[model samples]
Target: MFAFIISRLLQALPVMLTVALLSFAMFAYVGDPVAIMLGQDYTIAQRDQLVADLGLDQPFFVQFMKFVVNAAQGEFGLSYRLSRPVAQLIVERAPATLELALCAAILALAVGVPMGVYTGLYRNSWLSRFFLTFSLIGVSLPTFLIGILLILTFSVWLGWLPSFGRGDTVNIGGWSTGLLTWSGLKALILPSITLGLFQLTLIMRLVRAEMMEVLRTDYIKFARARGLTNRAVHFGHALKNTLVPVITITGLQLGAIIAFAIVTETVFQWPGMGLLFIQSVAVADIPVMSAYLLLIALMFVTINLIVDLLYYAVDPRLRIGRGKGAH
Candidate 1:
């Protein structure tokens, strides 16, 4: 397991470097960030001076090295637009995005696993038909469309929830267990549903297919024949084996959810890294944008590491497959 993890870490190093370098290059070349930041009135010399001050005049390698060294000291650089530390901006806003992503993930798991399990179990039954139709719509429809539809139905027409932001300013920092009560959960419903839609569909299908495949295996058949009840055959034996691949897919999906959170945060005006990232991009605030991307990359790396660690506990084959599975 240790060897496998070390290998995965080694593999990820180059990928992380490439993603960072490519993202930074795109930031540099896609637009005149200085011009975008400084606006039209700034003269050519002024822009040049600003570039030099920001080390834009330096070689690309030099700038990258500087960013790496400075970043090591916990300096993510200043946001040209916000005139604030990029790290601070992200830290301040991390909670909202984290809360939203977690809520969405929970909602997806709650709805998707059961939906898939029952659908696959029943096969051609009415419940199976219902899930099949629902999964099709959930999978086919884009996330933003789901968000809009929810807003129209629940907020606009039904007037059941507030359409924007986390909540009133009064509730911003206060933590009451009661907040998790009805009103708080209600506030979470729309955003959770909107963010969870695609994941739910994805998990439903994955779990269904996995469950069905597991049920057909010799062990499951034997379990059923050995006087094991249908419930035990399906839930215990089948679901256990299904978790291995499900773990891999679910972990990757979580990383994807973080990426997609940017979009959902934008659509709902949810206060999160996504909202901040969009604002930073629009202003060409390189530091904040870069930090946001970096943090996101770190999230993937960290989660993958955790997932890899989980393998040893789940199955010894994962630990034993060290070299034979090497790329």
Candidate 2:
């Protein structure tokens, strides 16, 4: 397990470097932040001085090397637009995105798993068909559209929830989260639902497929022949076996949710990394944009590492292999 973990981490190193370098190079063609910031307010010499000061006049390789060194130490430089540390901005706002992602993931698992199990257990039932249809809709509809519809229904027409902003927050260990507060949770509901819709559908389908396959296996058939209750046979045995692949899909989906939440956050003004990323892109804030890309890459790497570690706990075979490999 340790060797496997080390291998995965080692593999991620080049990918991270490539992502950072690509982000840096891409910004060169995305229009200049300095030019946008100055906006006819500065002379040619002043512009040149600003460019030189920012090291933009340096060779691309030289700039990339500087960026890589600084980024390794978590110094993402100052945002041209905000005049603040880009890393600090990301740190402050990351919790909101994390909160949204986590809430959405929990909601997806709670709803999707059981629904999938039921559908898989009774594939031809009318109720199963109904849920399958709903899952189809959930998968088919785009996230921003869902967010708008939710806001229109729950906030605009009903006036039950706020349509925008992180409503209330509490700081813990320098990280502020709105998930813990009543008002914040209420505010969280719409966006979380919007962000989680696709994941919920995806999980439902995966579970249903895995459960159906597991049900046909020898152990499940034997369990049923041994007079075990349908509930115990399905839930206790089949579901447990179905979870290994489900876990892998769920972990990958989580990373995807964070990546795609940018749209949902923008629609709802959720004040998370997505919203911040959009705002940064609009102004050609290279520092923030590059940092955001790198941060997201790091997040994907970290989540995959955690998921890999969890495999040992979930499956005895992997654990046994690890033990043998250690020798």
Candidate 3:
């Protein structure tokens, strides 16, 4: 397991390097940070000094190497727009995005898995049909549209939830969280649902399909032939096997939830990294943009590694195969 983890980390090194190169290269030429930072009143000498200070006058390779080294130490220089350290900004905003993503992921799994199981078990039931239709709607709608619709229905018409913001949060050791407050939890509902809806539907469909497929396998027939109860055969065997693929999808989708929260965050005005990225883009905030992309790539690589590790836990066959190979 240690060797596997080390190998995965080694594989991820190149991916991170590639992403860093692309992000740094792409953003390095997007706009003049000197102009944005210094404003129109600055003299040419001041501009020159600023450029020199920022290492912009250095060779491209020198600048990129500096960026890579600094990034490895969690430094992405100062934000041209905010005039703050990029890493500091990300740290302050990260909790909100991570909290939102966590809530959305939990909601997706909590709702989707059961709906999938029920629909798979009783395909022709009216409730199953309703779930299928609901999933179709969830899958069909765009994220921003869904967020807007949710805001309209829940926030505007119903007045049951807040439309925007992370709401009241408690800071614990510099980690701000909304989970402790009533208003915070209420604020999370609509946006979390909106962000998670598509993932929920996708997970439900994937689980249902996997469940159905697993139920039809010869092992399932053998289990049933042994006079096992329907619950035992279905839940104990089929559901367990069904979850192997579900775990992979769920892991990947968690990463996607964080990466693609931009639309939902924009629609609802959530004060997370996604909203920050969007704001940064309007002014070509290169450090923040590059940092965001690099962070997202790191998350994806980490999630993929986690998913691969989970296969050994969820599917004993993998462990058995590895054990055989070792012998």
Best by lDDT: 3
- Taking all chains together, the TM-score of candidate 1 against the true structure is 0.86
Candidates' lDDT values, in order?
0.80, 0.89, 0.92
TM per candidate: 0.86, 0.91, 0.95
Q: Which ranges of candidate 1 are over 4 A from the true structure? A: 30-53, 168-184, 322-327
Worst window of 10 by summed lDDT in candidate 3: 318-327
Q: Model 3: per-residue lDDT, tens digit, 1-327?
A: 887799899999999999999998876777777787887798899999999998999999999899999999999989888989999999999999999999999999999999999999899999999999999999999998898888888889989999999889999999999999999999899999999999999999998999899888999999999999999998899999998789989999999999999998898889899999999999888999999999999999999999999899888878876666664
Model 3 spans > 4 angstroms off: 41-48, 324-327
Q: Which scores greater on TM-score, model 2 or model 3?
A: 3
Please, what are the lDDT tens digits per residue for candidate 1 over residues 1-327?
566678788988876777678667766787676776797797888988998888899998988777767765657877888888988888877777777778888888888998889887889999889888988998899888888888899999999986777763234553222135465566667888888888888899999999889888999889988999887888888887887777787888888887778778877888878899989889778878878777888789988888877766787676556647655
Q: Arrange candidates by lDDT, highest first: which order?
A: 3, 2, 1
Query: After TM-score superposition, what is the CA distance of residue 314 in candidate 3 from its true location, in Å?
Result: 1.2
Clashes of 1: 0
Clash count for candidate 3 is: 0
lDDT of 3 at 129: 95
lDDT of 3: 0.92
Candidate whose TM-score is highest: 3
For residue 85, what is the lDDT in candidate 2? 96
